[model samples]
Target: MTHVSGKRLSVALAVAAVLATACTGGGAAPKDAAGGYSAQPKQTGTPKDGGTATVALTPGLSPNYIYPYPPAAANGTVVARGLLWRSLYRPSGEGDQIADAELSLAEPPAYSPDRKTVTIKMKDYKWSNGSPVTADDVVFSMALLKAALAESPANWSFYTPGQFPDGVTAEAAVPDTLTLRLETAYNPSYLLSMLTLLYVMPSAEWNIARTGGPHLDYKQPKHAKAIYKYLTKESESQSTFASNPLWKVVNGPYLLKSFDSTTGSFSLTPNPAYSGPGESRLDQVDFKAFTSAAAVLNQFKAGNLTVGTLDSSFVSQIAALKAKGYNVYGAPAPARLDSLVINFKNTVNNFDKIITQRYARQALQRLIDQQGYITSRGVYNGAGSPNYSTAGHGSPYPPAFGDRPPYPYDPAAAEKLLTDNGWKVTPNGSTTCERPGTGPGQCGAGIPRGQTISFTLASANAPAFVGARDVAFASAAKKLGIEVKIVTKSLNYMYANYGNTYAPATKNEWAMQDYGPLYLAAGYPSSNTVLNTEGSFNLGSYQNAAIDKLINASTFGSDGKSLSAEVSSLAEDLPVLFLPTPHTLVVWKNTLSGPQSSFNALISFLYTPELWYFHDASGARP
Candidate 1:
């Protein structure tokens, strides 16, 4: 998943614009004259065969784990996995499709009439060791994946109790064909979306539990568990990443040439025996890591970096980079939503009861000034769009309240709603519940009179926007006498130690949290393991029977419209306080040329650097 940033329910707030422009050097970016920022660079020339490209890893999100399916504590950072081991189906950069047919290792799956079994035909691909990549490898990967999930749902974010690897069985019945038998039927579209995340590893080379040990059948449950344990342990030794024989075996375009445990930087070289779509033209890729975005901007200024993303806070530097011979383009991170996730289990100040009330939730949502947040120079700097639904902006499955929020930002309305619901509205003072009962106009059940709307908000320190927006939210809430106490924490710390289910002891410590963005699969964007009642990633215990039913319908039913209904319901429900969706500004050297599809930022941050090449004096177009 990708982590990536509304408010008045209207009014183009002129002062915010003035302040935004003043902070950003007056012009956020130069006009395209030709249209706007294009994902693909417009270069006219042949690409040079050998040259190293220095890429910048997202600030605070460097590759700490080389293995696919990292533990929950890893904070879901994946930059090297795609380059080392390709998934069975390559993600189609386009929003219209789930997987790219031409680049996939396997052909489009054929489903049985009963829609319970799927047969997959593998393409001719080979591992770095020159061995043919077969369906056996796919089965091996699935086996290890199930083993990982069996250990803990926190092992994989996409995991749900009875989903994907749970009741499904895989078999490689033929040399190049793999068949899967499912215990239950699922929507084909949703199933295809899940498959895009399944990366294939070499079974013959990586089927051992220890170094110099004999290989075992990965299909066996016990053996698979041992193998998974071994690989995960090996992955922990970051210092030996380049020397590890287990990490060297790959079917994708590049190989791990070296890794820097100290700085989290690494380099990749083309695998000589790789059998994939791209030319693998670049001689090497140096993924540089940084502690902050400002350092990356400095590297760009010095021409020390070739490819990287510009933080929203640094959008003002776009024109300066363009002058330095760079192609800069940006779009909202695809299938991503940034929100202030509420901890429904937090009993502090009776927050659970207050938040559980639909009116209370609506009042809290209205207090958020989305427009003001995005327009703030310290925040998104006009690099984001207002999104009220989990479906995000430009989603194929849009809520009924298209563009307009169900509860718009109006402090007066927010105060009125609270007052109507047994609250005594005291501007800039503690507003307490005057009436407490299950009846209408009363602060729902379990809430007692004199209960105040005060809760602690845990905010992530990275991304800048999370803290900026939280401060803005707290400020807005103060006007309505809703006390919002914010506590800042590192992203990794929050990911590892701040969940209701995973960290029950601290469940009451945080009433709400803003941990940047959560990315879903590219095309489908299912909320299955995220919003579901039993979802492992459901940080807060938000259990709604109606939402559960809607999720099930979208997940299992044949009708795709159910997703729209589900998202619309979620938008109105305010499970989490929706924030503005921010754009991920991708910047690369002008000399780099590749297919336009390679740079699709929307599709799970898709980037095919293997297909890119330098088109300079030595390698000019014909």
Candidate 2:
């Protein structure tokens, strides 16, 4: 979970073109500026490489583990594993949408007619230590991942029951090919999507035996457990990252050079043995941590940093930064969304009755002035739009769902819906259920007479913007005869109370939750993990047999029609109140050129630093 940078503020509307010119080097303007921006400058001459690019890292945001699988901290996943690791398929193109999968460590997979088996052809790549990255490595990595999942189910939430490395059997068919035979028929597209994020590890480094033997057999529960325990200890050795022999066998584009725990800073040098597209153009890259956005902006102002992001609070200062020849761009944050998730399982105070009511949920959605919320919150210059579908607006599947508005902001409509639903409204205050029944147009089953339409709404404590929005939501709800009491909690605490797998609703404690942007994994847009009855992220425990069917169909649904149908169904269900997609503000020096400045999924952004480069000898704009 990531925090909103700061108070939301809109960028100047007039500077859109300037920002485009600076970030894209006068290229065609982005179709949706808020969705994402490019830092790739249009060049007039040949690229000159060899310089250091300094970046500002958010303070206190450090990766606890550098490995990708078995889940590490978000920061660590984004900065450490994201940069140091390479997956079989890479996320490409702009926005959070699952762009075309770029071949990385493997070629396109070959699937059996039944779609139960897949054959992957590995690329002829080499690890930093000069060892060939072959099918054995891929198979071994899968075994380790499977072992890790079995040992720590909490970390691998994406793996469904009896799936990959569990239900599927893996074998090295050839020196360069690995075959996976699934025990059950599954969606090939979804399987491919999942593979795009898998970080293949070096088998030699990770398959060690803890008990005086050869490499531990991942197939054996005892050996797998021992290997998992050993890796866990290595992963937590934050102070020994640079010296860890196990981490030194990376196959990605950069090698860790040094780390300073005191400053939360690290530096990377291009991996000389890296065999991938867009070889490093810079000699080294330095990531420096800053306590606040102000400090980052100050460093940029002092010309001490080459690239960093500006919080919404700093959107107003873009003009000044551009005046100083810095390039600023608005990119859509990858998979990030702010939403009001209702707890359907909550039985405390009979809040479940009101929350479970479709009309009540629709009324609440309508009461929200999405446009006004974006404006006052001050981010992206109104680049935000009302999101109605479960998938984000930038998600590839939303367009297939077609443009549909289920509930427009109509306070009168909201009020009437409540009144018509048997909720009695006092002239200047909250409402009470006067007609509670199991029939249509009534506050569904279990609602008692005289029950007030009141519940607690909680937001994260940081990112003043979310709290501000919470207050605004409460104010609007109150005006329409709904009582919404706002409370603040730390992000961790909020998630503990409302996260998937574990939620306060188990004790019937929470009603509504508001927090930072929730990012979907790259390559596929499926809310199954967040919406399905058995979904790991199903915080509210919202269950619908019909919705479940749609989600299941979408998983392997072959055509655009199936995906469209699923998204369309979700848009009407109003499972969660979708909020605006916040603009990702990028601030960078004009000299840097490459894909690093362009919009890719957030996960890809942190991992592909090799694509960044200096345009000239002096690292100055040509």
Best by lDDT: 1
Q: What does the lDDT come to for candidate 1?
A: 0.78
Measured against the true structure, the TM-scores of the candidates, in listed sequence, are 0.92, 0.87
Residue-level lDDT tens digits of model 1 in 5-78? 00000000011232222211111222222224534465456767888899888788666777776655445465
lDDT for 167 (candidate 1): 83
Error of model 1, residue 432, in angstroms: 0.8
* Candidate 1 segments whose C-alpha is farther than 4 A from its true place: 1-40, 73-79, 617-622
Q: Give RMSD (Å) of candidate 1 vs. truth.
A: 6.9
TM-score of 2: 0.87
| Candidate 2 least-lDDT 10 residues | 5-14
Off by over 4 Å in 2: 1-40, 43-45, 58-60, 70-79, 93-103, 209-213, 333-336, 377-381, 399-401, 462-464, 503-509, 596-606, 617-622
Candidate 2, 118-139: lDDT as tens digits: 8988888888988888887777
